[model samples]
Every structure is written in structure tokens, then in C-alpha cells.
Target: MATTPVTQGSTDRRRFRVTGGRQTSPQQPALSRWELQALLLILALAAVLYAWGIGHAGVHPYYGAVVRSMAANWHAFFFGGLDPSGWITLDKIPGALWPQALSVKLFGPYDWAAALPQALEGILAVWLLHRIVRAWAGPLAGLLAALVLTLTPITVALNRHTIPDTLLVLLLVLAAGSLQKAVGSGKLLPLLACGAWVGLAFQAKMLQAWLVLPVFAAVYQLAAPGSRLDRAWRLLAAGATALLVSCSWLLVVWATPPESRPYIDGTTNNNPFTLAFGYNGLSRFGDDPHALGAVAGTTASRTSGNTGWTMLVNDIVGPQISWLLPLTVLALVLGLLWRAGQPRTDGRRAGFLLWGGWLAVHVVVFSTSNGNHGYYTAVLAPALAALTGGGAALFWAEYRAGGKRRRALPAAIGLTALWAVVIDGPHGRFAPWLLPVVLMLGLCGTAGLWSSGPRTTPRALHSALAAGMASVLLAPAVWAASCLDSRYAGSPMSPLAGPVGPGYREMRHHGTKPRPHALNTPSVRDAALLNYLTAHRSGEKYLLATQAAYGAEPLLRATSQPVLVMGGFTGLTPYPAAHHLNTLVSAHELRYVLLTTRRPSTSAVFWVKQNCTRVPPRAYGRIADGSFTLYDCAPGV
Candidate 1:
């Protein structure tokens, strides 16, 4: 019984070809003109939404301080002039000051100057992702990836605020994009551009540039096995170029006078490069007794470190919205597996690997280094979005394959949407039925992808699928927007309606001002006493002694009275002088001693309180508020 021979052409006709693969059929065109139009429309919509809310977001107080200080002291040739009182400490990366300074020069002294650059960078990042993914993945994947990034909660928040993270992220993404193009096309110019971007990333955040490099190299090697050595050399050259570009300012700072160095070194220190590159970098990794009050000081409490990490992650990724948390983990796993299988075809897979690797490196380093913050996780978000996009695409494809499988997609989307509405919804009111509505939409999308699967389908279904993906990506953004209106826009429906919330009710009843509570508030009578000194002394430079003297620098600078805060680790200031100040405040220059009677509850506040006793009571003024006393340290009273 001889079976009829199965012809190759007949067999090929029956097989279902994956979209964008080698299989060709006249019936199924690669991508309809309409699909391309839909994708572009989605990209445009995502860009507008991401960029729109940036100006309105509340400013981060610390970052705001950094920007203001830089703006107030901007000069054409040298950045900010020397720390007036020789008490400078933070001078590690002069690069961080330039951009803010440039913003001030261009837009005048406003918070918007500092923030606008980051917002623009964020929009550019979205555009880059769209282009990169569209080049490699299909339009569907490109649209999904871009949408996910645009509406990501953390991404939106960071874009809106003035912080280094957004700049770092933008530069990192650009570097990744350049590297992707360089590896794909084997172009030296792209490689050189990649180096320049890496340098920009380094200037933005110091040493964090290397986080993305290894992953890019690894992915490139895996993707193009034959050209591994050549790729490695190109990457090395790029890194060298970046190092040269980034370190130019530092090299200049190193050659400047010690007095001149106070602006870059922060303190009257030996070498700016050694202090910043060494103490600022290595000391952060290792424990140091002299580093107290510094960002990485041993005396710095765990809470501060943890809060930093938490803020970092929350700003980059959406707040671990309870409903999305588990799904995010699953998505990450699926994304990695999917990319692993796909390998590096057009640098898309490599890009994913680089992002994932960068995120992982920072998480491990910070988590283990006794310093971790949620905001640090921002670096990983683009990669996470890619993963989520891939996972969503895979899930949709599976859902379309079988009716039983279809339920899972709806269930997931329903729960996520329901969670958003319940916790992040416009009103406190719970809409239980909204879950079903989302589930129905999910079913519709599944049907669309299924019917459109490897064959023809109605244009509306394609549009619906694209819309659904956009909605998914916008989930976090919409929730955030709702929160902003509810909290900041005078909406009674805001979930934060009680005493602890932001508005008239909060300040009128709770004694908590709507303003950010800076450490220099007059709540400490010493702060008031210091203000009084500014009134009386007028123009005389004074050294303020205390462990956390720098805490009051912004206030002191406001008075145009130079002050050197004693007894804290150097920040804004260079190392040796920072170390000297950490040891003791010279009583000759220290004309005013601010003392707090009570120990501070938190570590930062504690540092402020610890140095208060260094001044002699005989030289002090009458106690104000029973919590603090001010002393006039002028020679012989």
C-alpha cells in the first residue's frame, strides 16, 4: 500500500508561517499600509502623553536644591565659584553641575530649566525605542515596546522631575541604540557615537556607564559569533573614547589651584580626581569611619540607604502596584526565555540583554553594598518594558491559538485593569464590573490576533489589538495621572483626601505645611537664630560648626553669608579637607555654634544635633524653643 507522495509545495502551503518570517504568500502581505499607519499613530500618542505631564509633576526637594544651587552660582568659564567658606564637600562629579548650569543659562533661574532637558530626553528615548524595535521586531512589537515605555509610571515621574536618573537613562538608551546599530551594520561611526553616548551616561551618573557595556558586549558576541573579536575591539575603543570625553572636565579640575578646586572638590582637598574617583567610588563600596555623613558613610543609617533604593525603583518602574507585581515577575521570566530562544538577529535581542544585564548589575551591587533604593531600579525599566511587551505579544499569540488558552489573557488583563481601577482608580469607589469589561476586551483582542493569525482579518480587529496594547502600556500612566489630579488638582475624589494628604485640609488641620520640609526649617530654634545672625552680621563670612553643617548651606547661601558646616563627611567638597572637617571644625573661623538640646530621631537630623555641643555655652545666645541655643563664636565675645 504505497501512500501518495506529498509534494513539497503542497506541504509548505498548509504550514502556518509566523509573521515576518521567511515564508511568503500573496494572500498575507508583510504589513499592510494601514498597520504601519496604526503603529505610527500609536507612537505619536504615546509620545504626547509621556511629554505632556512632565511640567506639572511636583519637584523632588533634594534634586530641586541641587538645581537651584547650580543656577544661583553659574559663571561662564568656571562653574560655581569656590565654596565661600572652604566647607565644600560634594565636589565629586563636576559633570552633574554643568547641565543644570546650562539650563539656567538658557532658560533663566527656574526649576523648569533643570526639568525640561530630562523631559525632552525622555521623549527622545521613546522615539529611539520605537525606531530600534521597529527596525528589528514587527510593527506590533515596536508599538507595544514604545507604548510600554511611554506610560510606565516610573518613567513618567522621572521625566517630569529634575533628577540625574532620567538623564542617565536617556543616555544609556542612546548608547544602547548606537551600539545596536554599530553591531548590526558594522559601522565605525556608529561605534564612535556609541562611545560618545556612554561618556554622556558617565557624566550623568559616574561609573554607572559600565553597567550597560558588558551586557551589550555579551549579546553582541552571542549574536555574531564570527565577529566577536572585532566587536570586542570596537567596544573597547568606544569605551576609551567615552572615558576621554567624560574625563576632560575632571582633568582640568585636577590642574586648577586647590582654592579653585573648592568648587569641584568641595573641600580644600589634595586631588579632585583621586578624591572623586577614589573616595567617591571605592569608599562607597567599602566601609569608612571618616566617611560619616557622606552618602556612603558607615554612620549613615540603613533607613536612608533603603529609602534611596526605594525611591530609585519607584521613580523608574511603577510603584509595585500590588496587582501588577506578580505579573511583572512572570513577564520578566517569559521575556528572558523568549529572547534567549530568539537570540540576536538584528540587535533587538542584544538590546534586551544589555538592558536586563544593566538592571541586574545595579540591583546586585546596590542591594549588597549596604545601599539600595527603589529608584535605582529605574535603570532596568526599559528592559523590563521590553520583556513585558514580548510577554504580552506571546500571550496574545497563545490566546489566539486555543479557546482554553484565551481565558488566561483576559483573566490577566482583567485583574490588572481591575486592580488599577480599585487602588489607583479616579474615585475610592470600587468598580467590580470593570474587570469583566476588560476581560471582554481581552477576549476581543485574542480573537483579533487569532483570526488575524498567519492569515487575513478585518482592519478593525488589527486596530483594536493595537489599541489594547496601548491601553496596557498606558495603565500606569493613567493611574498616575489620576493620582496627580486627585492629589494636586483640588479634586475631592482623590484617594489622599484626609489630613495626611496635600491640600488645605492637610496644612490647616495637621500642622504639616504643603511645602516640602527641608532640614533647615526654623523648627529648630537654631535655624531662626542663624537667620537672626544673617540679619545682624549682614555680609561677614561665618563658619557654622556641627556634624551636619552642610544641611544649612542652602539657607546660608540664601543669605549671601558664607558658612562652613563642620563635623560631617565631605560631600560637594573633596576628600582630605572633607576628612579634616569630619574630624573637627576650626574654632577660629567658626564664629557661630548652633546647638540642639535634643538628639535627632533620624540619622541625618542626628548628625545636625551631634555637632551642636561643640560650641561653648558662654558664647551662646538665650535658648529659643527649649530645643536649641545659638552661640556667637566671635573672638572674646
Candidate 2:
């Protein structure tokens, strides 16, 4: 998405600047030497932050196993099917997995390869966001926004995983930048292109991608040069194009005979359309009474008392993303006020509306929805960074303009900084030097903004701005650093938002652990199970069966042998009913079953206990944590 910020792009040719009404360049030049150097420096920093010691970042094993399976066959790859044998498709569309599958396939399906693509994609998002902001505001704002996004804890955590959210965000940013070009230049093509990018994002993540549609329509209607009627028609055309692009994959997957492909994993009826509309769609906004868990396998029932306006303060979201919440709010307010004096059709106002709409929509939807996860806050990171970064820079410029507005800008920043420090302050386990550095910057920036001195020393202003940036940047930077240093990894990535200390608590709700349970791998127990399964197999369709993918994942990745996950992801879904499992056993299609002591369904545990011979712990080497029991489906004839 952030394809080299070169000069002469369609979006850059516009006359109006996002920071103000400055006009000079006919075609925006490439990043100057300082700009390029600065950009690379931050990108390097981001790379280190995102990928350093990344192999240890315990990515979800279920997803990792699916990618491994996907690498074995293209049909499984295309369908996001859970297994290579094409037994069940993953809950969501397969678009997001394509890149991960390729990476795993090419790199031998290791943890590093599974996560590297998403990390790189997240880095691209940083650059793309910088370019987009730079095109609207200026280089300074762009750099600031980029840095803020880079340090976002949730951003780091999610990017370090194999989840599709990072890629989905990159596609959205690309779509938004294109839409801005369409509005600025009155070009139909850019609008179509924007639709295409967003459509692809929809393929990556279904209903959530459409959140920005209203903003896109409004920006074109308000700012594009064409007549209102003309713009409306063009908008409709773009919408149709988006629909076509979004549905392209869905149609193909749906058109394929159900019997020929795997049953869509998350749906009751084995249909992609039903999965999209049911489990992964509206069910995300509200829990499905009949369903056992969220599509993301997160529980929405834990509120931490976060509802209504208190949503911002909730233990779930506050630490990960709300550090700059106040600043973004101020940005929306000030950005709007700054533009109110200009033409009603001013593009700056449209930019605010676009980011503001995005901020508001996600906040409200996540705030109100019971099905929200703490990691869902990753969606909020970009909008907050764009507004706060670009908005803060805009205020600094206004203050340099030397008026009452200038004085107000300092007070505004000071208050916002105060809010951020208060919200995230308790979470920082900083060295003694850290607080002083943050305070000094806050004071210097506050003084510079507060000063009514003559316009003689710009260095003072620069110092103040740096201080402000430092103050805003400090806590999240520290916390994100802690996230890397801690043993923390895996899904529900946002809850571990604070530093690795007291305030950094996980959300224990809806029958799930508050944090990722440490997975034991490469252990003697696992090796023993693998050895037993490998030795006993004789033309069986599956070498093993487990209550959930979690137990079988180590073996799945260790060998090419197929494993039947009796219950899907959560181990609660009623699958391969007792009789059906017996049928498979009778046919010698499955032999070994591993019953994890963790949340297996009652019926499933009962079936395994009554029907199979329980292998003694000593017979299979050391079983750590007393968490799993290996059973022989039928040891010998």
C-alpha cells in the first residue's frame, strides 16, 4: 500500500494542502534527502520493534496449523479450510491466509515465516499512513503519525501474529488514499480504484471493511468538483464496483459444489454466505445464543464495566489504544474548527470527516457491541494516529502563526498530554530517567505553546514540539517495548496493552483465560505421542483425533499425517457424533485420540473415556501440566 512515496501521483497534484491552504508544487516531489533518511530510520526502528525475536511470539496454533495444511494443497489454501484433507473450512474467507500460506510453504511452515508477512504488512501500513498524511498535511505530520502508529502496542502485537487485521488495515488505508484522490481531483478512476482496494479488504475481513463507505461517499459528494447529482451517480458506480470486487471470491466459493469442497468450518449449514452473514457478521456485533464462541474465538461477554462513554476507559481497550484518545478527539474538534472558516467544500474538512467517521464508527460499534474483543482495538489504531499526528502538527503550525489560536494550541496539547499520561501513566515501569525526560518535554512544549514572545526564536518552538511529541509518545513506547520483552504473545493481543506489570491485566471472561496459556512444545510427551501415532498407523485416514486443534497442532505441524479435530477450534462444537467417530474407528480410519484436560465437550470426553483404552502416563513419557491424556482408540485387534 505504501509503495514508495514518489512525486507526481494523482493525489499529490491537488492544490489544497491538508495543513493549510498553501499552494506550490504542480507535482509533489519525492521525499527530500532528510525526509528519506528520516523515513528509513523509523522504518528500521519499526522493523526491529515488529520482528525482533519474533520467532518466540506465540502465534495462534490453530491458525498456524491451518496454514501448514493449506500449504499442502491449493483447495485448502483457497478455502481457508482448517485441514489439508478438506474436512472443514476456516471460519473466515481465505484471502488473508493466502500470503501466510505462501510464506509458510516457502519457508517450511515455521513460526517466523507464519508471522513475517503480517509484520511486513504492518510496516507497509506505517509507510502508507505516512504518505497519505504527508499528502494531506506535510512531512512533519506524516513522520509523527508514522511513529505513533509504529509504537501502538496493539499494532505491534497484532502485526507480530498471523492474523488478517494488519493486512485488512493496509488495504483500507490504500482505499482511503485513493478515495481522497478521487475527491480532490474529481476523477472517476481513482474512485473505482478505491472501491477495488476496499473490496479486497472486504475479502480479507467481511462486514468491518464497509465501515468507511459513508465517509467515502460524503467526501466525494462534498469535495469533488462535479455537480452533486454527478457525484452521486459516480458514487453509486463505485459502490457497484466495490460490490463486484468483494463478491468475486464469495461467488466462486459458493458456486463450487458443497460436496466437492470442505464444509465451511464456522457455519451451521456448511455455506460460505451463511458463515459470512451469520457467525462472522452480525454475530460479531452480538453474541449468538446457539453458538459456543465468537468467530475470532474471543468472548464478548466481558465488559470490565466498559459501555456507553465509559467504553474508552474500559480495562479491555484503554491501555492498548486509548493513550492518544483525547488528542484524537481534540484533533477532530480543532481540525473541524480550523476548516469551518474555509469553504463548505474544503477538502481539509472532508479529511477530518473521513478520519473522524472512521474513529467514531469503530468506537461506537465496538463500544456498543457485546461481541467485541480487546484486540478489535487494532482497528482503532490507524485513525487515532492519523488524527492525533496530523492534528497535533496542524496545531503547532497555527501556534507558529502567532495569535490567540497559537496560545490555545499549547493549552490544548498540554491538556491532551495530561490526559494521555494519566490514562497510561500507571502502566509504565520506566527507569528513573524516563519520567523526568517525559516531564521535561511536557514542560518545554507547554511553555513554548504558552509563550506570548515575539517571533524571534523558532528553536524554542521546535524544542516545544519535540517535547510534546515525546510526552505523547513515551508511555506507549515503553509499554510496547515491554510487550516484546515479556513472554506475552497470541490472540486477544490487545489486553496485554500496558507494561508487563500490575495495570497490564488480561480480560478473563466468557469462559476463557485472560491471557494466552503457555503452549508446551518440543517436549518429550509430545515426541512420545508423535512416535506412538507414527508407529501404529496402518492405512488409517487420520493418524490421530483430538478434542480440539490445540492438542493435535504439534503433531499436525510435526508430520504430514492428517489429524481429525473432533470438535473445531474451541473443542465445544458437536462434531463427528459418537456414532460417527465409532464408525471411523471401526474402519481403521483413526487410531489414537488425545483428550486434552482443557475444555473438551462432555460428550466428547465421555465418548473417548468409555470407548477407548487410556494409555498410562509412564507409557508415553512425561506429560507435563497434567493437561492431556493419550488414549488408544483400539490398541490392537
Candidate 3:
């Protein structure tokens, strides 16, 4: 038959023509013109939310101080020391602090300079989630998943700060994406890269990176085009690769001489091994299930009843996150129900399994840990978003095929919509009018889905789907918007997001407020103490000795001078023994010893109290806690 030629890139046009042949319809592009515009809009929104008012002095002055110190010298930067003195290391890994250090080094040390890298990393995370979900589920799922991630308030709050969790989350997302790419290509190199990504994530947050390895390995083994034994071998090699990457810095720290390197701060012994495997790792889960301050958020006064599973429900996570949490759980259930007993090599099933594994592992681990923070739960946001997008897309595609599943789609849509609003709506802080509008639109969307017949057009179907998703998203979107302006100075641990009125002010680092121990900036009282130390320095390395890092932080930040903290975060851990303190004083490395009232008992404190003279209160300005004693630790005083 004589036929008309088809246009290039048009498969359907080639298949059918009006030359004694039938015609074919045009198929849509992977990302349609409007969808592409929508994607850009979503990314723009994320950028504004993450970057807005990000320049305030950081929430955790401790890490900000570390970043400033790391930017000053090579030793402090490499070892992640608590200050420029390089006398002691910070209580965490070096890698997590590196990006912020670099940011400060390049842009000059400011809170915004330290936080800029994390904000950028957060933006990239949104884009990466979209790319990964789109690969497994399709473009619509990818776009929807990205939208969900950007709207998560906890994600926005944590990302806007200088916390290392932002980097950890980004690296883990990269690892997830790498494995998805490997499954698609059936390539060994991409699989290898996935392990490397996980290893890098470990550098960001030690043991937390390995949580997803089981899911990645299982997916790769089943989906990769290779023999089972060979795949297992490769997986082991990948694990080895991850181990090596994570342990490289540890090896360097271990290899260094004790005298030349800063002492590891967190552990009982000043060593990297104990710091990694003990303090920051196993000790996080208290053996005694009900240890005090074991689980975070609940121990705080406002979150009084937030314990166990409810930790992620109301006070801690419910209002901050959990807007789409019920739907995420529903997505997991539906994913399992939809793809029961599929092939081991099923890609969609693998995607669902991966996301489910993330949520399951984190929830169980965090729920059990007394050391868990509300901010720690922020890492779960992307996984929840990915599952929602992929699961919803899978269900929609299946329903469109006119079967038993199709009849249930409308019901699922309606139920999920109602559950999303009802779950956190009452506890949520949103505009008075916003809640009613969300409910009305959600009801209309549910009705549209139920009333939709086979004759319903594609545009109408899409509109209904958009409405349903938006209903799940509205509260979080409002919260995330508020996340942009929230100023949680000193410690930005709160996950509560809301609008900041003119009365809302950033918490400044001054002694006016009842501070833990000297704010980063000096008040009149602190300045008087600083003047005394500066005046009394008799050729000493440390200007003064304090009970913990809290006491020394203000001095170090204000004067760029060396001040020694005997213990670390808790102030109880033994570090410098009496002999070490005597040696420092004898060697003229330390002079004045300032002890906080109700401080942890140490032989060094007793040594200073017995051997040195206490300064009179009249010599220093008015002190908040007069129980804090200043001892003259000068040699032969």
C-alpha cells in the first residue's frame, strides 16, 4: 500500500497513516511543557524557603565555633577540634564539619557563610529525589515526590541550619539514586559507586549511613544481570569499599602521635575508636530502656507526653512533619498489597521495598534510642515523599486499566485525603481560613474521582489527582514557608514552624538571658572576667581553665584566645587528669582555673582549689551564678 511518510521522533505517526491505512494518536512527552514549568516553580519555591533569612547567627553555637576554628588552621580542620587552640577535638567526625569550614574559609566566618553550603545541599537533595523517583516510577511521580520533599517543614528547618544532617541526607539520597541507576543499567560500576556514596555518607554521620545497605544490596542482587554468587561477591566488595572510605580518617587519627594531635573529646579515653563506636554509636541506645533524657523531645517540658511512638506523632514530629505521614504509611501498605509475590527482579516492587526499608529501619532505630532528637527524624522526609509519589503513581496506572483495582482507586483517594487532614489538622498551626479551604477542595477532589466515568477527559483526571495531593500537602507547605524565617538562635532544635511577626527577634548571644555558660559574645560580667584573664596572663598557653566547653566558648569566640575545657559536652567525662593539669601549669600552658558551681568532680578541680588561691568577687564583675569560683593557678602563686 502507498503510504505517507511519518514525521521524525513520532513512532505513532509511522505506525499509522491515511494512505490506505488507519491513523494513530500522539503520545505525550515524558515531561510535558506545562509539567516542566511546574517543576521549575517547585524548585524556585524550595530555594526561597531554604535560603530566606539564613544569615542569622547559628542555632548551635558549638558547631559554628568549630567551623570558625576549622577555618583557622590545618590541624583543627583535619581533626575537627573544638577550637583553634588544637588542644582538644570536637565530639564528632571531621567530615561533617568540612563543608561548613570550607564555606567559612572562602567567604569569611559568619553564620550565613557556615550555613550556605547546607542550604545549597538541601536544594540539590530535592532535585535528586525527583530524578530518582522519576527513574523508577515516571516523571509525574518524580515531580510529585520532589514537591513533597520541599514542603516538609523539618526538612526545611534542618536544611536552613549548619547541621551536618543536611549533608548526611544528601549523600544518602545520592547513594539511593546510584543504586536505582545501577538497577536500570545492570552495570557493576554504578553498583560500586553506590557503596562509595554510602561510605561518604558515613563520613557525614558515622553508623547511620549503613542502615540502607541491606535494601541497596538486595535490590542490586535481584535486579542486576549477573549470577547470584557473583552478585554476592560484588556486594561484599562494595561493603569493603564503604568500610575503607569510612575508616580512612579514623586510621589517620589513630596513626598520629598523641602529643601532636588533639585529644578526641567525646570518649572516656581520648581515642577515635571509642569516640566512633562508643559515644556517637552504641551508647546512643541506652541499655536501660528508660534512661533519663534517653529519648529527646519528650524530656523537654513542652513535649511532656511525647514518648514512644507518639514521639513522631504530636508534639515532636506531628506538627513539624507527619502531615503526609499517614499517607506515607498507606502508600507502603498499598505498595505491598499491589505487588505481592511479584518477580524478584520487579523494579517497581524494588522501589517500594527500598522506601519501606528506610522508614522501617529509621523508625525502629530512632524509637528505641534515648539519644534521638526530633531533628534526627528529619532524614525520613525524602523517603516518605518518594514512597508517596511512587506508590500513588503505581496505583493510578493500575486503576486506569479497568479492573478490580480501578473500582477501589476512588475510595483510596477519598480515604487518604480525609486521613491527611484529620491526622494532624487539629494540632497544626495554620491560617484560620486555610484549613476550611483544604477540606472543601479535598472533598471536591474525592467527589470528582468517584464521579469520573470512562468518558472523563485526561485533563479532568489530572486536576482531580492534583487536588488530592495538594490536600495532603497544604499544611506542610504553610509550615515550610514559616521555616524560612524561623530564628532558632543558639540551638535551633525546635521543629515547630510558624510565621514570625515583627515582635519575633533572633536570639542574640549575650549574657542577658540565662545562658548555659557564657554566650558566644561577652556581657559586662563576661568582659570583666576576660579583662582579668587578659591582664593576668603570665606567659601561659591557655588564658583560663573552665569546667566544660560551655564556659570556654564565649572566651574563645570573643577574644580568639586559648581557653581549656576540662571535659566535653556533658562536663562529667574525665579527660585531663590531675597530673596533666599540673604538667600544663608547670609548663606554663594553663594559668587561671575557672570552675562552675555544681560542676562534675575531677581531681584537677581539687588540685586547683588546694594549690591555687581563689580570686575575690570584687576583682571580677557581678557574676550570674556566684557559685562559679575563679582560682589563681599561676605557678608559685
Whole-model Cα lDDT per candidate? 0.50, 0.71, 0.70
How many pairs collide in each candidate, listed in order? Answer: 30, 0, 3
Per-residue alpha-carbon lDDT of candidate 2 for residues 1-637, written as tens digits (9 for 90 to 100):
1111212223322334333322222354578899899999889888988888777654565666777888878878887767777777666788887898898888875778877888899899999998888776677778888988999877887877667788888899899899877766667999999999989999888878888888788767776665678888999999998999988888888899977887665555556776666667756555563343333343422333345666666654576778887678888897788677655456666778888888888887766766455566788888888887678767766665555566656776577667765665554554445656666777777877586477747686667767777777886787677557544433433335443312233322343334332222445556787776777778889878887666867666655557787666656445667887888888888877888777546576688788898777776676443888878887463
Clashing pairs in 3: 59-490, 294-370, 295-370
**Candidate number that wins on TM-score, 1 or 3:** 3
TM-score for each of the candidates: 0.68, 0.87, 0.86
Best of the two (2, 3) by TM-score: 2
lDDT score of residue 400 within candidate 2: 57
* Decoy 2 TM-score against native: 0.87
- Runs in model 3 deviating more than 4 A are 1-35, 286-307, 340-342, 407-409, 425-430, 455-460, 487-491, 494-525, 623-627
- lDDT digits (tens) for residues 379-410 of candidate 1: 66666655555445545654555545444454
By TM-score: ranked, best first: 2, 3, 1
lDDT of 3 by residue, 1-637 (tens): 0112112122311222222112222332366697689889989988888887777624455676677777888888999877777878877787988998888888876667777888889899999998788766667678889998998887887877767888999999998888876765556777788889998998899988888888788767765545688778888888888888888888889899989988887665567876776666655554532122111111221222334666677544565667766567777887777666644555666677788888888877766655455667778888999987876666676556655665454665566556655545664554666677677767777777767888999899878877876776786787677665434222443434553211122333332322322224566777898988888787888888887666766666555576677876555557678888989988988888888865566787788888888888778775443768888877667
Overlapping backbone residue pairs in candidate 1 total 30
Q: Under the 3 Å rule for N, CA and C atoms, how many clashes does model 3 have?
A: 3
In candidate 2, what residue range of length 10 has the lowest lDDT sum?
1-10
> Candidate 1 regions off by >4 Å?
1-57, 74-92, 224-226, 263-348, 359-371, 389-460, 463-471, 486-514, 517-534, 538-561, 567-629
